[model samples]
Target: MSKAITNNQSVDLISDFKEITKMRLAVSVVFSSVAGYFLGAEVIDFVELLLLAVGGYMMVGASNAFNQVIEKDLDVLMDRTKNRPIPSGRMSVKKALFIAFTFTILGLLVLYIINPVTAMFGAISIFLYVSIYTPLKTKTPLSVFVGAFPGAIPFMLGWVAATNDFSIESGTLFMIQFFWQFPHFWALGWWLYNDYKRGGFFMLPTGKRDRGTAIQIILYTIWTIAVSLIPVFGVTGRLYLTPVSGILILILGLGMLYYAYKLYKNRDEISAKKLMFASVSYITLLQIIYVLDKYIRIWI
Candidate 1:
């Protein structure tokens, strides 16, 4: 009986840890960084790639843990976040803080070993997410804007990790992801506006689910599509989109814009949800296209 009880306790601990770190979201962040690393690397080093993945996950996890700690009180008021480890009392603040600190130090150290520039960007991402963005969520709608800085860094950080340089190539990658976030997050804000209000968060740009918010989503969707096509122009070094991939990217962008337009026209949760899913598909497909195009260009 005691052995069985111990096993159950171990399972509970693991589950709590996953909840605290938001493992799925961390993995997605690592995927973007890995895609950037692949684009930047002239010769792939598997070991460095492994380190990048681990460090990226650690940094993202730490940021999430810190956000939970800081927002525990507010989190309890929101249905979506009320069950998180901290807010639900599944974990203590001191334990969560310890995990956050450990992950932060280890993550930065690992990235530093890869390259100083990568480590510096990783540190900045954590600072911006935890210190600036987390607190600003309740203060102003601009929190999404501030959050985008760190949110967009992973894609570019991978490039810096591989090249140890910040050039037009990395800048273009950053800009692409940066604009993508506006529509992606606004769609989410639209869908979760009521829940957010319950938690005292002003995440939407207009502070309400209105025409102003939908118009902004459409405008940013346009900007996201426009910036995504820039690589095909041959300006961003080491990142190029061939004609085939360019056309496909345009189609993907249009798909997202179509959904955004639907949301604008309908101004309903269903439309917002569709736009949210469309935004996710747009970014995933766009990145895959970029990476495939890079390799194809190299082989030919």
Candidate 2:
């Protein structure tokens, strides 16, 4: 009976840590970094790849933890976030801060071992997310725009980790991910607008389900697609995509655009949710295509 109680406590602790750190989101960030590393790599180094994934996850996890600490009160006002560890009272603010500080120091140290540039960007991402984006969320709708800077870093950070240098190829990766965030986030913003409003947060551009916001989403979708295809022009150095791969990516873009149009046409919660899923699908599948295309080209 005593052993059972101890096991239960351990499980609860793990669950609380996961909630505080946003385990799924952190893993997705790590996935983006790994995909970027693969794209820029000449020969895969398993050791370096492992370090990048570990360091990347730690940085993202630290960011999420800090964000929750900042938004603890606001989070309680929203249904979606009320159950999160800090807001739910399952985890104390002191404990969460300890995790955040530890992760930040150790994460930067690990990244610095890779290269100063990679560590520098990692620090910038943390600063932007925690210091800039977290506070700005309640103040202005432009927070998403500011947040996208750090959100887009994981992919580009991977390239820098592998190459130890930032070049046109790395910039192109950053720009593609940067544009992709608007549609991805705005769709999420649309569906979660009510919850966000409850927290006194500014999410959507207009802060309402209006034609203006939908129009902007559609426009950004087009821009994202256009940027994704830039590599096909043989202009992005080592990041060039073949025509066949370009067509596949274009198809993915059109699929995402279709959902954005659906949201624009319907302006309903359901359509907004669909757009959110579509955007996620687009980014995940696009990364797969990029990695596969590069490896296939090398083999051929």
Candidate 3:
């Protein structure tokens, strides 16, 4: 091959790798793990935290790669996903499978270095996302409900990695994220209903962007907000939340709820998009608050 053509091919390969892995989303998911680690660790071990982040990203990336492979054909029908590596013919199924397996193994090994339980959760996450959730997408809208299990694991996985135990604290973390995803994803689903329909994805709970879906989104947003504040209660044990932090989280949740309410009233794509962004901001800020609260409480 000519030198110029070879360089172009290399660039394409790099781009394809990013697309298959959904790099940005993977990093965001890993951030949730880092937040969980902060809550679990008594004395911060930077090395363990680094390992958790890397391993978490790898597992998430592997799941995305496998998802793209399984949905290659359906992906091509949707504008949002038609340009992905496999759907666009930029990557082969064989190569993508190789990457997925490699990531799964390496990710599990890294998590195992932390603790056996952590590694087990990592394995479970991949299995759910790839084997169960991915297949259920076209078949039922309940796929999101199932997918939330793997989605919720990263935050709890971090806590499990640090403590080497699954406690009510970790379960609280899982429940918070689990409830949070409904409004978040349904908002995105509302905005992209047409696109998802083209891909045969059952995203909406009621399978339509009607009042039923909007009302559920509002209800779930409320539930997500409630779950996030559970740490303030004594039931969560070590995962304590001060009144000030609780107030802050409440405000953030209210903001997200406001957006959801808007979507309900407007029942338009624009409103849905706004709610989706708001939900993302709420969860991310919620993590930041939890981490900062933990450290601040320690210092003071």
Candidate 4:
């Protein structure tokens, strides 16, 4: 009976790890990181790509694990989060902490093996996300600014990993993702106001889905579009935007903005959810365009 109980406990541990790490979210974040790597890399190395996927996934997993550890108490307050492993009593605090540290160390080691700069940035991202942004989320809305730093790093992290150094190109990659987050997150805040409020997470600048917040979202949406088109003006180095590509990008940006404005004008839950979905579509489509544009020019 004791041996059978031990076996059952082992299976439960594995299950709890998956739940605590938010495996789905972790996988999506790593997918974005891999997509960035493909866009930035001149040569698609299978081994390097594997390393990137592993390191990126573990880094994100570590951040999320630490986040859950810190917010265990608050997680129980939110309806959407209360079923999480930590808050639901499926995972112990000590076990979660151990997993977080293990992933953090292994992720840094994997990135370092790939390239030192990659490891450095990976470490920095983990530090910022776990130490600063996660704790600040409940304290102030400025946490969004803090959170964006780590959130945007994956775009440039891939560049540095591929090139083994930072460059203006990497900065440009960072800028694109950095500007994209404000409008994306604000839309989520608009739609999930009650859910976020329950946990004391101040996700919006105004803390209310009002005209002021909506206006900021629209302004940032415009900036996201403009920055995306900068390559067309011949200012973004090897990242050229042909007239056709530029036009397409502009259309997509405007589509995103159209919904942002609609949400602002309507200030309704339905509109907010629409804008939130649009924001997800915007990022995914923009990345696809970047990759497709590169391939199209190569084949032409």
Candidate 5:
């Protein structure tokens, strides 16, 4: 009976590790970093690429872990977040806190091996995400803007990791993603407004599902699409979008805008959900298109 109890405890410990680190989310962020690296690196080093992947995962995982730890109290208030390991009592706050520290330190150390600048940015991302974004969520809706800073950094961080410097090129990547976040997050806020309200999180800029919030979403969606096309017009260096790819991207962007408009016009739960789904598809597909364009240029 004692042996059975001990084995169960061991399994539970392992499960808690996965929950705190959010391994699945870490993997997704790592994939985006690698994709950005491949798009930016002039000379690909498999070893460096592997390091970037692992270090990026650690940094993102640490941020997510700390976020859960800090939001443990509020997590219990939202239906969407209520079942998370911390709030569900499956993981103790102490254990989650310890895991957060371990992941953050290990993640920063790994990135430091890549380059100090890359590591510095990684630390900044985690800091802003947890230290600023988490608490600000309840205070103001501008938390989304603050969150976008760190969220956009991952894509540009890969370029800095490869080049060991920040340049207009990296800045352009950051701008494109930075603008993309507003519409994406606002759409999510619209769909989850009730859940967020229950948790005392004001995610929408206007703090209501009104014309103001919808207008902001549409405006940002336009800006996101415009920034993405800047390369095609020769505004940014060494970045060119083929006419074909640019057209396809524009179509996708317009689709996103249409959904945003729908939300504004209808102001219903169903419309908001559609916009949320469209925003996700737009981001993932945009990254893919950018990567494919890079490879196609090599072949051409």
Candidate 6:
């Protein structure tokens, strides 16, 4: 009976931890970093790869936990976030802070073992996400821009982790993801505009779902596609995209643009949701194509 009670307590704790840290989002961030590592690595190192994954997860998790701690009150005002650990009373601020600090220290130490540059970027990402972006959310719509900086870091950090040097290749990766976030996040903001308003978050460029927001989304989508094709110009050093992959990327980008255009025309929730999904598909497919193209060129 006592063992059963202890097991239940353990399960509840695990659930609370996952909620506070946003495990799924953390895993996706780690995935982007790993994709960058593959692009930058001359030779794959499984041990270092494992460390990157774990450390990346922990660092992102720490940032998310801290964000929750700071936004606990605001979170309660939104349906989507109200049940999160801190806002829902599943976890206390003190406990959440402990988790955040533990993850931050451990993550940075592990990244430092990989390389100092990697650790440096990890720290910067956490600081920017928690300090600048989180607080700016309620103040101005430009918070998305600030958030994009940290949001874009994982891709470049992966490259730096593998190479221990910052180069044009890493910069290109960073720029691609950086621009990608605008359309992706704005579409999300469009769909969640009401919820965001309830939480006092000014996430959209126009502060409302209007033509201006949709037009900006389309503009950023175009920019994202253009930057994604930069490697085809053969100036990104070790990062090269074959013509076949480039065409596929263009097609994927067009797909996203089409949806963004539709959202502009309709200016409705359904259209925004479609744009959101397309944005996700575009980034995921683009990253996969990049990794696959790299290996394909190696074999050829």
Tens-place lDDT per residue, model 3, 1-300, is: 699999999999998888888999999999999999999998888999899998998899899999998999999999999988887777899999999989999999998998899999999999999999999999999999999999999889989989999999999999999999999899999999999999889999999999999999999999999999988987898998988999999999999999999999999999999999999999999999999999998899
Candidate 4, pairs of clashing residues = none
> How would you encode candidate 2's per-residue C-alpha lDDT over 230-292 as one tens digit per residue?
999999999989999999999999999999999999999899999999998898988899999
lDDT score of residue 69 within candidate 1: 96
User: Distance from true position, residue 189, model 2, in Å?
Assistant: 0.8
Task: Give per-residue CA lDDT, model 5, range 203-256, as digits (tens).
Answer: 999999999999999999999999888777766675567888889899999999
Off by over 4 Å in 1: none
**TM-score of every prediction relative to native:** 0.98, 0.99, 0.98, 0.93, 0.94, 0.98
lDDT of 2 at 109: 91
The Cα error of candidate 5 at residue 47, in Å, is 1.5
What candidate 6 gets wrong by more than 4 Å, as runs, is 1-3
RMSD to true structure for each model, in Å:
0.8, 0.7, 1.2, 2.3, 2.0, 0.9
Model 3 ranges with Cα > 4 A deviation: 1-5
Per-candidate total of colliding backbone pairs? 0, 0, 0, 0, 0, 0
Q: What is the per-residue lDDT of model 6 for residues 60-172, given as tens digits with 9 covering 90 to 100?
A: 99999999999999999999999998888888999999999999999999999999999999999999999999999999999999999999999999999999999999999
- Scanning candidate 2 in windows of ten residues, the lowest lDDT window is 200-209
Best by lDDT: 6
Our model 3 lands, by Cα RMSD against the true structure, at 1.2
- Residue 216, candidate 6: alpha-carbon lDDT: 97
lDDT value, candidate 2, whole model? 0.93
- What's the candidate order when arranged by decreasing TM-score? 2, 1, 6, 3, 5, 4
In candidate 2, list every pair of residues with a backbone clash. none
Candidate 6 accuracy as lDDT? 0.95
Query: Per-residue error at 291 for model 1, in Å?
Result: 0.8
lDDT of 4 by residue, 1-300 (tens): 999999999998887888777788677667667766776788988899889889988899899999999999999998988988899998889988998999999999999988999999999999999999998999999999899899888877877777787877778778888888999888888888998999999999988888999999999999989888887777766666678888988999999999999988899888888988887787777777877887788889
